[model samples]
Target: MTGALQADLPIYDVRRPVLRLRPAKAWRHFQNLMKDKENTEEVFHIFESLPWRNLRPSAERFLRSARGQALRMREPNLPAILDDHAALRQMPAGSLAHAYCDFMEREGLTAQGLVEEFDRFAKHHVQFQDQFRWYLNRMRDVHDMLHVLTGYGRDALGESCVLAFTYSQQPSPAHLFIGYMAGLNIRRQVRSDAPVLKAVTEGKRLGKACPRLCEQSITELLPLPLEEVRRKLNITPAMHYREAHRTWAEMGVDPYDLLGKKLQKAA
Candidate 1:
């Protein structure tokens, strides 16, 4: 919100693009992803190919303003920092870096894996300015970090919830469409739509309450405890997703996996 904090922010402003994007292709890919629910490649394709022509102009002022440049300067060398566990471990216990390291270890994930995936995608698919690509790459890199910060798991429901939160924060139409479609799929298969709806609604609420994370300096935030980071960002708990995970676990079922099963059958 503050122009001073936003100047150097590398967050994409959805302004006019020099590239000719294919919205239809993006839409089709999105539909396929919704049906399969496992084709992560399609997810990248959708975002990469989708025409943001109608969406970027609105955010252009903030994205290109002098303030945004300042924010960008404060942006962290995330790939470098996250790649070294020793560096991450040196941070405070409750810091974002600490939480990220813990999450990666607990989930058997690696920062390198995320980086490799994005690099591979960029090498073949993304063709844009270095600055634009930097912005996109940063978004791709921080995505899972956001999931951790927002208290969303890597489950089907969690993905929807995160997307919902994203739309609220950036109001990107592509994110909204993905969230909406995912919610619909879960609603049709699951006996109860309450959890699905609640996740989305709560995400929207959290997005509204929080500052634009895209403008924040990740390097500065990583050394602070998770609670402190959340406080600074105005991020509240994602109660709906948490409760749903608990309920489904208590029922002796992995709700996330079940959603995928139902989707496969429908497909």
Candidate 2:
């Protein structure tokens, strides 16, 4: 918020050919993704439906920042760096890089997989300047890394909370909408006392207070202990999220698969 987006704080201040919001299309994509959670392309389509003001302005500012200049100078491929498990494994124990590597290995995920998922949508084919693309790719590449930093798992609630947190950092309406909808659905469907909305809202608050992780280099943060990294990033423990999880457990609701099962039945 301080750098790329701060040039104009107002929503209307935008470049030519403003990306208009298509609520109906975004809703359809959301429905398709909710019904079949594996359809990751729908997620990208949702973002496209409610596109950002041309990032040209953001790109202009990004190019002026130190991190932006460093990225441009080296032209490091973020996904490639994340995929290099060998190199990441060499990071010190308890480091963010090591935890991230472990999480990726356990989840059988790769940064490249997210890129491939977005590519399958085919709607992101619009031409963008290299700096704009770099800025865009940087956001996409940090999705899983966010999970690690925020202490959020890949479960349904975790994903929702992370999105809420992301909205606070990036101020993306789509992210907030999805997080709100997801939290609503979970609370309505799950027979539990879990404070779903409270947890998600807390995520947003935490994110608003935390520093912009996108402004920092992944490699630079990788070598530090996770706690140190979190401290530097101003991320606090997710008290509400942990409390909600405990309540869900007490009520015998499986947070991981609860939404899928309920949604499939509703459909």
Candidate 3:
């Protein structure tokens, strides 16, 4: 099989990357966050302050526990995820994105001009300088495929729930947990209702029930040209795209804006 095609394949690893953090570096990050605690607290506080809230304490506890599992796990799925992304980048221009756009168009999820957005960004942005941009793009690109796999929607709540699941299963501290927390905050802001909150809680709980099951779900539902067992889920590309767009838009702001800049500075 060609390397490009192999990008969609599942990867199982028993180890995670270790960061040898200098105390000073860690302290800087902590202080920066502390300085902006109000903004961060506001988002999370939304969850705590909501009425008709059905985010069970059990579910919340489960998500926290899952986060702990991710932290303690030896190896996360970063290598595999990055490998898949590199493979996608190698495909012909009209290949993967076209497939995604076609799927979205057929589902009435996005307008015809959608591909242009990606094209525009790809043309103007040298992703190498901004690894975070590359990360964001990879996240956006595969996001719909993930939805097709997991049967989640594009809403703030649904996406956050799936992210929490992804973080639990994959255990990537840099991307997974940060994204999960952001999604949780955004979901709380947008939909504080009982059903929405319940879905979020249930998604996390189900994620905790079987991390391997969740990972397999991601592998199976990816919209790649693979012969893996396909299970029909309730999610659609449009829904996933919509939710991803919302979440990333929020991430485009100040502190998070520095994500790409940080990588550039380090480089």
Candidate 4:
């Protein structure tokens, strides 16, 4: 699979910014954190260190396209609002903010928890071209919103699905690496690849149907009805993750515990 993905490596011009990604290092961290999800800070470092400049070029192209220019012009004042997750949680139901909050709470996550994680990573080291900064910041802040919009949970399989969606939309090796590697681990534990494969396929399908989410003005979308937001973004409901979760529950197999036990057996 890795060989096939490598065969499809994108060839950009020499002038494009190089992200200097270290896949082996990132993969090692990915394996370690599977057994200990609490080490989310390490996962952040893995992603941060492997910056994929896919967004920078994609945004530039989108800005010049006819439909994209309109999107850029109408781009709402969103930075301040996107950074305020607590306030967003208090927003009315059916709104993007409300949906985001509900997804976080349902998944046993907190915005502040993720924010502190980012701060811990950023405080020590963060660097990028001025051109990529805006897009990168928006991507980092709106991650949970993607989970809500895509109807994916924060569980192991859910995260893989989201990463699959990201890879489809963004064309990043970082996302592909994480998604593929995690999917492999999950398949190994479950001894069945069907669930993970289905979730990833659904994610890729959704990504293709939707526009570039990173460029969307969250301020404009946040207050709109959730169904309307989905319509505008061309997003559809995802069911594979929910079904997979149910199967796992019925089998009494905790995904995380299974992962840890598998790692112990392997060691």
lDDT (Cα) of model 2: 0.79
Highest-scoring model, TM-score? 2
Model 2: worst 10 consecutive residues (lDDT sum): 1-10
lDDT of 1 by residue, 63-154 (tens): 56775555555553456656678988998777898888887788787756776765666675544333444444455677778787898887
Q: Candidates sorted by lDDT, descending order?
A: 2, 1, 4, 3
> CA lDDT of 184 in candidate 1?
75
Residue 10, candidate 2: Cα error in Å is 25
Compared with the true structure, model 1 gives a TM-score of 0.78
In candidate 2, stretches whose alpha carbon ends up further than 4 angstroms from where it belongs are 1-17, 259-267
Residue-level lDDT of model 4, residues 195-216, one tens digit each, is: 7778777887887888767777
Each candidate's TM vs. the true structure? 0.78, 0.87, 0.33, 0.74
Residue 110 Cα positional deviation in candidate 4, in Å, after optimal superposition = 4.6
Name model 3 segments beyond 4 Å from true.
1-17, 20-142, 173-180, 187-192, 208-267
Prediction RMSDs, each to the true structure: 5.6, 5.7, 15.2, 8.6
Query: Would you list the C-alpha lDDT of every candidate in the order shown?
Result: 0.70, 0.79, 0.38, 0.68
109-171, model 2: which lDDT tens digit per residue? 999999888777755465433445556677788989999999999887899999999887777
Clashes of each: 16, 0, 5, 0
